[model samples]
Target: MAMRGVSHVEVFVRDKVSAVRHLRSSLGFAHVADCVEVDRSSALLRRGEVQVVATSGWATRAFIARNGEGVAGFAVTCDDVPAAEGAARALGAEVSALPRGRVTVTGIGDVAHTLLPADGHDPGAPPAGRRWVPRDGAWPAAGGAWALERVELRLPVALRERYPAFLSRVFGLERHPAQRSWLYSAPAGVTFALEEQRAPVPLEPPARAAAGSPPAASVTAYGLAFRALPAPVLR
Candidate 1:
């Protein structure tokens, strides 16, 4: 498979506006586009080379109702989408054809990969609908103040070996030696690690009652790692 690496990640949330605001304020992401349909709303945000689509609507509500707000899937850029989809299917991966010639391959847990052409179409671009005013300008270059460095997946200890093998066979990622986890480096410089977990683990402890907030969702199948770059000095 001619995998170029992850193009963008899709996160399902209850409120697209709030989610986008949080990402912009907390992660330094810039709102790029918005798509609003009768049933749902989605916003595109970017920082460095990382793009995230936060969506909410009927389908999103149902997803969050079941799984809570978290990453739903990610798209990978491919030189040949059809060929990559074929390769993934040959590896016994559950594959589904999405609209606009995109392909989705189910991965561990609920996470899936949407295979997209590598012709520079922003996978995070606003889908067809009522379009919000798009911010004009090129996306910030990679290696900015904060950049996604790695993505760590926590799965059952039983899948520690099989999952990595699956990724290697399907995506052609190269496995590397790691102390306590399985690390695979993608061609586009993203490191993916599978960490073993005997039982379900929450991302953080329950929110205090007086805080009047719900506890954070249990750790999902994956978590992102970002690095803080040094501020550029001006002479």
Candidate 2:
């Protein structure tokens, strides 16, 4: 089976409603779909080809409770979810079942994950009302608007080999030539680069000014960067 590269980035937040509003109003993202259950809420948002799955729940919130609100996991689209799950299991990923149509897996360092098959999975399409918005307009020569350029994974120093093997087994990601990392791609022009982190991890909320304060989005020791499209594609 030909598994696609990274299709979406999934974030675990405290409140899905507030996150949806904030992403739309402040971050220029538009909601594409909402999947809510008895205790969890997930909203899919898009800006250009970039998509995000923002979630909140007891299980999801555990990432926040332990690491604070930040990107908890990433998802790579696959030809078959069960096939991917089997591959992940072969690579030693901790696995679990999800309702409707999804599965969760964790590799070394317990990197959290969710597996969704390519068919019938509509986190919906890009929002209709808005155009794309670029942060700096420093679009790469690569013609595609909004491609995943890089992603950082804060893996435990010990579980180095297992993480890369897990990504390779599940997504067929090859090693990037320049960086000592894994790369996956799709026909739709999505690129995912995963780098193991080696910095001090911050568990508490980063320091803030005062009440009504918002901490800097750049505080986390680990992060992922997605390349943006040209101005025209955004529109």
For all candidates, the clash counts are 0, 4
- Top model number, TM-score: 1
Q: Could you tell me how far off, in angstroms, the CA of residue 233 lies in candidate 2 after the best superposition? A: 11
Could you say which candidate leads in lDDT? 1
lDDT of 1 by residue, 1-235 (tens): 6568677777777667777766766456788877677887878777766777787888776445545566666777777888777777776788888776778888555566777777776634543224665767443344445455666554556666777776776666776656445555455666776664434333342223346565332212225655555579999
Lowest summed lDDT across 10 adjacent residues in model 1 is found at 214-223
My TM-score estimates for the predictions, one after another, are 0.67, 0.61
lDDT of 1: 0.64
Clash pairs (backbone) in predicted model 2:
132-234, 145-229, 146-228, 146-229
lDDT of each: 0.64, 0.59
Question: How high a TM-score does candidate 2 get?
Answer: 0.61
Which portions of model 1 miss their true places by more than 4 Å? 37-39, 61-68, 98-101, 119-146, 154-162, 195-222, 228-235
Candidate 2 deviant stretches above 4 angstroms: 14-22, 32-41, 56-61, 65-68, 80-83, 96-103, 119-145, 186-224, 230-235
For residues 92-151, write the lDDT of model 2, one tens digit per residue.
678887764667787456356766677764433321222433334322122234555565
Cα deviation of 73, candidate 2, in Å: 3.1
lDDT for residue 233 in candidate 1, whole number 0-100? 94
